[model samples]
Target: MPSDAYRDIASLPPALRFLAGGGEATKLILERDWSDHPLGPPEAWPDILKTTLSTVFNSPESMILAWGDQAQTFFFNETYFPLLGPRLGWAMGAPFQVVWADAWQQAKPIVEDAFAGRSRHFIDLPWKLDTDRGKADTWFSFSYSRVLSPAGDVAGLFIFTNETTERVLADAALRESQEQLRLVNATLEAQVAERTADRNRLWQMSTDLMLIAAFDGTIEAVNPAWMLTLGWTEQALIGKPLFSLIHPDDLSHTIDGADEIAAGQNFARFENRYRHADSSYRDIAWTAGPGDGKIIAVGRDVTEEKIAAEALAAAEDQLRQAQKMEAVGQLTGGLAHDFNNLLTGMMGNLELLQLRIARGRLDDAERFVIAAQAAGRRAAALTQRLLAFSRRQTLDPRATDINCLIFGMEDLLRRTVGPTTDIDVISGAGLWVAMIDATQFESAILNLCINARDAMPHGGRITIETANKWLDDRAARERDLAPGQYLSICVTDTGTGMTPETISRAFEPFFTTKPIGQGTGLGLSMIYGFARQSNGQVQIHSELGHGTTICLYLPRYAGDALMPEEEEAIATAEAASGETILVVDDEATIRHLIDEVLEEQGYTVIGAGDGAAALKVMQSGARIDLLITDVGLPGGMNGRQVADAARMLQPGLRILFITGYAENAAVGNGNLEPGMELLTKPFTMFGLTAKVAEMMKYVGG
Candidate 1:
């Protein structure tokens, strides 16, 4: 407990804190608040001990030292932590003998030797210690020397140790091998007498299949290892030609291998397949060499290894596909926004223009107005398809019977494709049910049939078939799908088949084999999105000049299809009813269009530029019968949050949220919240007015 002992300890000679174990060891020691330590603190250590311990703690080689007859531990470097393991925590500043009590006998002598003014060095000495691994046997090459006191008497044990277990064991094996060689030369005659029985025992116990085949490839000898690998008895295998048991696919290869080993030239490491007792193939890798005009071979079953390698390759392919889809979705998210705005303006203007023509104000411009309106509506449809392909489509999935769903579309398909094209609807017996949005499923079917019709120039056959399928792990991985029961609907057409290039990009949005302007390229992409969102998959199979087949795999739902009662459409006649409505949107054109249309219907409408403005209007005591707001707004608050805030002021506030994106977390499934209604943008005037009336009805307006 010398106060000045540590005062100059940092001043120095590498025996102080100049550098300990790469200069960072002492940093860890100083940063630690050692007030609770039994030794009080580093500041109170004796001068002679402080300087000597500091030098040992910093030495690059693993080192530790114990001071006093109590064996109070003083230092251990970072390099020595592995040797002490769990005991390291209590070993610092602790009695070394008690901390390493599990190895006390071996450790006591080393410490006592140093304290007795004697130094000891040993090579590859074994010591058992209670460590992290519990009673581990470790070996070290070490030297124990006295840590002398300032009076030149032994004060502590100075130890330097390095783990040499691996090196020492390797050296032992080499020496054993050398000794065996010397004995082999001295007893060559004795070994020859025992060789036959020894070889027979080794061959019987070996895990690798040992075989001796004639130069003509007739097997003369086989080991018990063959029974473990191929499950065939010796009597069943020995007389048979070796190539006969080889897999048919691998028989020719085996024959060629025999020819190579026939010339007495040794060969090694050839792989092929061998038939198992179960009539399946096990991949086997073999090593062969020439022995006394015969072929000596050793074979090992590698079936599991082969399967694992295949699965890894398939997983890597799936990862690459997922990355490509993610990249495409990100790039199109912005395009969806810009295109949605343009669509809103175009659709709003067309609606206004059509309204004028409907009022007989532009009787002569009716035809022109109708054409432009049709084109504008098509552009809006295109935008929706883009969103669908990006998995942003809002879906209302329910239990659906795909069998009845497809059969019910017969008349529509005939009408669309005409008489020259033949349509056959084939349904599976006891078809598995699926969970899908019925409306979207119908549209997807129509899209596929339309594509089929286009493919057949002279009008060929279009067949729609349904079947139940269960995909196992390997099969599912190949398609990047989960292993489960699935309902597959395949549409096949006798038409000009698509090339590999076309088939590869078949599901990509805006990618089509048809000439420009002839195809929007969104049909298959939209179907792909619908399937993915429904937790299903779409796959295409085709060969040039052999026609094409498009398959839609939907997850099988075990529950019976629940038929939702269709609600009679609300009449727009009572849409106004003198109710007040609040409309919030960032787009001026859309807001103005809504305000104009609703005002004409006799409802009082309040317009806001964003969520904030809408909240301000409500705060100003405006009576709102229905809240119609865009989910994404510019004033820092989205429609859902604004609606939530407004509800605090008026608990009975009814909400109707709209967005161009298929789905948003806030408005999922259009059930926004209690007293809330959900709608998507680019909606028809009739649809919009009907929704407003429905929400108003809920409020008893």
Candidate 2:
């Protein structure tokens, strides 16, 4: 072997210290023929190269030192034997480009960077190597660093490398095995994580209070939401009895409900108050169910909601009260203004009569008297309309056929509306009987016809229709009426209709679209009040250019209708027999007038100013045939009390009540006792006599 000749180090030249005693690799280096080599002989080598060569030859790790331009010259130690295989002998002193000729394409850039004074490392770099067996796939890890000359210029590259094929292949096999195991477990683990993550997120982040409580009301676990909602930490709530936090007033009921839940029952909703951290109570609405020896409860904070609901109810009540007050104010103002005008006319005419009679112009007195009487009548009519709007007017309800009533009023309605408007009456066949006041109904129909006539400046059609209506729940709600059979009397007009604003306030008192002096504004409102007082409803449907329909829905009377009574001519009525009557009124003028009227009818009339004066007269045991009293009196006891006292004194006494406006309770809600009747104030002398005559007849019969 060529290495046997280099055994004697003393025989070698002095400059050959780099080829000193190493192993077989150093002997082989000394025996190499380098006369024609690019680096020449070791004796002619640079000191840095020789020093680096000695280090490379003696080192244990696989290392290579490449010198010169392009790092073409190479020197390696015996460690290369395992990596380079049979190529080691020639590859030791060869240029790296030639030694790794097959891998030069991948190695060239690294060599260039080292020459440019840059260093880089690669781990598990892959390569294809030709071997005795065939092409082999291999891996290597190496670091390439620049080596500088003494002049500080990059002259070569120093590399450290190791063959890592076995370790790299072993790691790949282990990773492949691990990936197969992971794929096998992915489905079940993903499902479990999905469910657990969702539950944990809901428990930790939800706003609603969530907890698990034992069957005995002990809290086992609580979500973080307990801290956020009620200012109690999860740790504070856990192991605490749930009933301990409940309000004292709500504790018993809450315990009962919890007991129910623990007994395998579900409570859809349960409300209770819980003590907050600040010592105030919060309302909690809980939904709970029993689950496997525990109770799962979800509670929602409803304190603010409850407060808002109560506030809304209070606000609604306040609004209704405010509306009522406003209506009262409007009604009072209207009545005062209109009554003052009527009073001026009446007083002026009476004053004129007084002046004429004093001046001995007796003939002129009758006209003034007539004028004052007319004004008085007008005032009475105004009071009646106002009473209708207030829904306190006296009603004489009877079961009457609505179709016959409309037919009977057809001619009168046509004459009242004048010649311009056309009247069309479409009365329904088999119309149901309505329990309504026929006189008031006729007046309501007349008022509607007059309004329809006024609506149309030019000629238009007025339709009066009667029908049987069966209002369902939804329909009844729209009309503000209860669901039942109703007799509908509708008056429709083709005229200049009302706007939305006008229609909305059509039934409000003193709310009219007519010119100020021309309308009292009580027409529709009067009809509305009258209908409601009769247990009925009225609705107005109108549009700007279309037309208007005013409907009256009167509840159907189940009984058979009776023929209306014939009105008697009471122009010259007088008392049929001698009768003693008592008249009680706070107003002296009214009391004196009633006394004169009764006296003129050939009856003894007794007068008193107050209820006490009347009761005193009744207590005197005088023979009183009848009692006529004003409902309102100045004394502490009203006329009704006087009547009661008089009845006790004379059990068979006939009583007559009179009032400026109908006081429903004062007049027995228009349900006078037998042998009793009512007469509204401002009654004519003729009417007063007629009522007395009829009562006298009842007594005589």
Candidate 3:
């Protein structure tokens, strides 16, 4: 069936034996068609071609042997597959001119010289190979020597490809010893010939980082670009282990990659870090493969690309945080506006009921009054939390003694939490005074205490401690703050602590660990916002099974502490004669409550439904003693717009603007003229009356 079935391959010359046993080469050499071959069947090849093929194939180097007068391929080894890929389909018995037509122009003269008995050596000769993936750029260092017949006439040629520096140089050195006159008269003479000058020029001029390494990991040669990129000379790179120049972190992986290349795997886009001469590292992406028992590698630097990718990630995180804050502010601000209106109506009516009971108009109303007061207080607490979470709360800051403030809350905290837990207060000696809104600071402390209490449903200790902290540059960097003095207030609780993931999001608005309905989830978020607004920081430390601690660091105020104001007793004096008060509100209950209270105080009272209605009455020349209006009212005007319009009619009107979120979100940062004051909603009846009396006093003067 085939010549191989009848002949033992080992009995043949080494070149014929190699082709007979090669996986694909054997099938191509003995099995493919050669009926039209100019040199006839492969068995009929000339003796010079047969021996030259054996010599080229037996060596562990890439080679192609072209035989006969017509230049037909007699043999090629497995290592030549990439250069001949798809071309191998017709390469078996085809003429070199037909199979390599795409590159025949550059190869024609080189082959002609070898057959003419002129030996030649070419380095880094460039060419292209057309395969399934299209034209590919390639280079080679090869030598062509004449193969002579027994009668001394030139019959064919052998091309020895120099894939790596060590193999090609070693071969060149060996040929110099035995191949004296034969190479002198053959293609070996081309090393000093004019035809090779262009190829040698190309070798020294390439800008790509190209290198050759032995299978055992010794570098053999490198191009000029390697020196430019890594600051290592070619002579320095040639004698060192290839992995020595690699980063320590990448050495083991690079060693493994070299093994893959040694096993004949072609690689592309393989990346690793390489060490530079300056003791830094450069990121490189490599393309490598095995060739002639060695490895050829090409690398491209990718340091800037990696840096750009990291920058993009950080920018994305900032955009996400900004978007999240914008969304949360819109939601919390709306809730505060609606809830404040409801609480004002409920608390105002409750106060009127209490007054009626005092006058004996109703009996058996004490229990109802107590329960309603507690519920109203709870509702007011929730409204404040929403306002703080939205960062729309108006704050009035004053320097205060932190130790005195903590001591004042002791009795109230004990009453609120019952006797289930013990309260401990530890104040620092000579602590720095903090700049904060005194009233809002108390609320922030109370919110933190309530959260700590919930974390420990069973009996536990709640410790409130204060200290003076002077943060240095390193500590300030960790907290993203400027180095300065701060007043530290810490609350510690013997409670179930939070996990790392839970702690990370603990300050996000509406994020809670407690069950639904048990918490509104705004306690920590409000505390966070308040601390930030005071030019301070808030931090939490916890573990899953241990206890938890939360710290608030407020800026140390340089000014002197203001003395706490003494509370004034409610006045029993009646309003002055002929003083008329104008009350405007959308809610009928709140409007009626104010009208009734002022009327009982012996003052004339008029009321309206909205800002538009209020302005109508003020324009009618009613000689109103004062104008009191809700900030968010129905009709085409808000409180601020209505105030602007009314001030034009009566330039010196005594206006008291009532707000929930309006002071921060609606009126913005603008100055008010004289004889104007602001009062937040959900105020006690006494507080509203006191403000009215104070304003009337100012009007009379």
Candidate 4:
């Protein structure tokens, strides 16, 4: 079919061999065929195939041709001429095992597997070759596959090979770069995880209620504190509208905050109310801002804080009222003291005129003196009322049963409130006894009833109750009172109540909610001062459109009760004895009044306008049996200074100090010394005479 059958085999891709004449140097026919030719001497063929393969593959120029089942060597390429040196041409027809005994040891397995139809590959296979130049060491990647004949029978090994030194070095470099990248990625992942854990811990451990809400006011996330504080589970709050949990009064404000965030505005220090799990509203202060495409808000409950602020405001108002009352007391005390001195002078003059007229010297003058005395008595009563409001009125403390006190005054209270109002008295059988002035107590009850009557234009019930209460330390601390037993007398009326603002200023003098002239605001102020002076307290509770309750708390008598004294014996009486009296005062009217009163009492009176003049009189060696001086004097000398100078001159001098403004009056630094006496000025002649005689007796003692 062709020139030769071997030409068909040689025409394949791999190199092929043919025996020539005697087989010295072999012809390695690549891409050709010579099997149909007769056997000729090997020296007749040129070694061009081995030379060409070596040059193309850049390998050492040496080649071996082995064939048949015994793998006998038959030819050598001319490129292997110098490798054998002296035996080069004789090696061409030698058996492969004899020619390459050492190489066969390594190549045998590769050749056997390939011949059995298995492909074999090797990297960095080390080999040596001798050339005309020198012996050379090299590495190669070798692949071996079985060459098959046209009949599909194994023919020979076909080896494909390439040098691999540069590729092996580049492989080491690539592996190092991949390892470094892996380490870098690992480090970055660890850092990311650490930051995530830190953020999670911060979110969980916070005490403030934290929430993440969407732009539409839907709650997207909430911290544990939020759930715990609201008493809600995670699922209950997630995806719900945030305003649903807010108080009704606060929902609009909260929604506005969301609108602000969506508009790219931040809200700071927004305050509103939220509904608690217990169904009460809590004052909440929040700060909300946009964060990571969501609105993050933190809030704190401030309900107790708000209540405390309201209580503080109420207490401040009460303190202001108390201070106002104290100012009024100071004014009243000053006026009453000065007024009593003038009344004493008038009464003494009236007494002198009456004595003269009683002798039947002039009937008309006697009638005038009697009429003047009647007018003086009325003026004294008015002074007493002012003194009571000032808390300077003389008090007669007694252990009076509160139930009996209320019962005794029920008829008067009924008359005071009028026929429209019904009076009800609720008295506890085991009520505690209070030590208070009975006259002031009656006045206080009358004043409260009048107030209650004014509050109700229509008919209403008036309830008076008495109870025994033990005020513990905690209650006392809140009320600013001492811990002790108390007798409480509560007066309540079903009348129109006052607003908080009105109630706050209720006890302030001259502050009235009533139409002008319908009420005098002094009623409650007087009651407050009297109660406080009697070691008691007054509490008022009222609400708009609701009724009012006024409670009086008086200290209970804890020790053995004392017997009440006769009231008549304690009243002031005219003195009988007459003595020389020295009267010193800064006010000219006061000086003249004292001098007239003492002279009318049958005592020789010496008057000085001030303490310095009184001192001169004493230094002049006047026989002054008594020194009566106003506490506030001009010329840098007060009553006490004049008395000290006078007493130095006359060791047995009787002294009386009078005062109107006692708070500013010069007196003892702490307490009055024994035998030293003081008399508030707005007194009657009888009271003045009694005080003068009493001091003289102390001089006698």
**Candidate 1 has which clashing residue pairs, if any?**
20-58, 21-58, 392-662, 394-662
lDDT by residue (422-456, candidate 2, tens digit) is 99999888899888888889999999999999998
Of candidates 4 and 1, the better by TM-score? 1
Candidate No. with top lDDT: 2
lDDT-best of 3 and 4: 3
| Candidate 4 collision pairs | 7-33, 20-40, 20-41, 21-40, 21-41, 21-42, 22-41, 23-42, 340-682, 340-683
Give the alpha carbon lDDT tens digit for every residue of 1-701 in model 3.
Answer: 45344235765555455344344555567677677856666677656566666565455677777776565555676567666766765576667677788888998898888888788998877677675557765667899987778888777777887444334534543453243333223463563452246335644676667776887789876767777788888777876987888888888898999999888666777889988888789998888876656677778888889999899999999999998888678556645754665567667667778788878877656655776777677777776776676566666566789999889998988777668978899999998888677888887788878887887889798899999997887578877778999999999888898999999988877677888667767788888878877778889999865778999999899887776542222233235565888888898999999888878777789999998788889889878778888878888788778777888888788888887663654453434557777788788887788788877876656
* Residue-by-residue lDDT tens digits, candidate 4, 142-166: 6776645556766544455565544
Candidates 2 and 3 compared by TM-score, better number: 2
lDDT of 1 by residue, 1-701 (tens): 23233335454344334333333345445655678766666667678777776677656789877776564665677678777776654456667777777878877777776678778898889877676767656778999888677788677777888988667755754564454344334454653444345566876788888877887888866888889988987788776788877888888888888888786444557889988899988898998866556677888888899899999999999999998888587547645754665567667667777787779777556565666666667767777787779778777666888888787789999899878799998899999989887888998999999999999989999999999988987568877789999999999999899988988878877677787657767899999998888888999998887889999999999899764343233333354688899899999999999999888878899899988788889899977788898988886788778888989988879988888875467675444466776677778887888788777777854
Clashing pairs in 3: 15-54, 118-186, 118-187, 119-186, 119-187, 119-188, 120-187, 120-188
Candidate 2 residue runs with Cα over 4 Å from true position: 1-198, 214-220, 235-244, 248-270, 287-295, 309-326, 565-574, 634-636
User: 1 or 2, which is superior by lDDT?
Assistant: 2
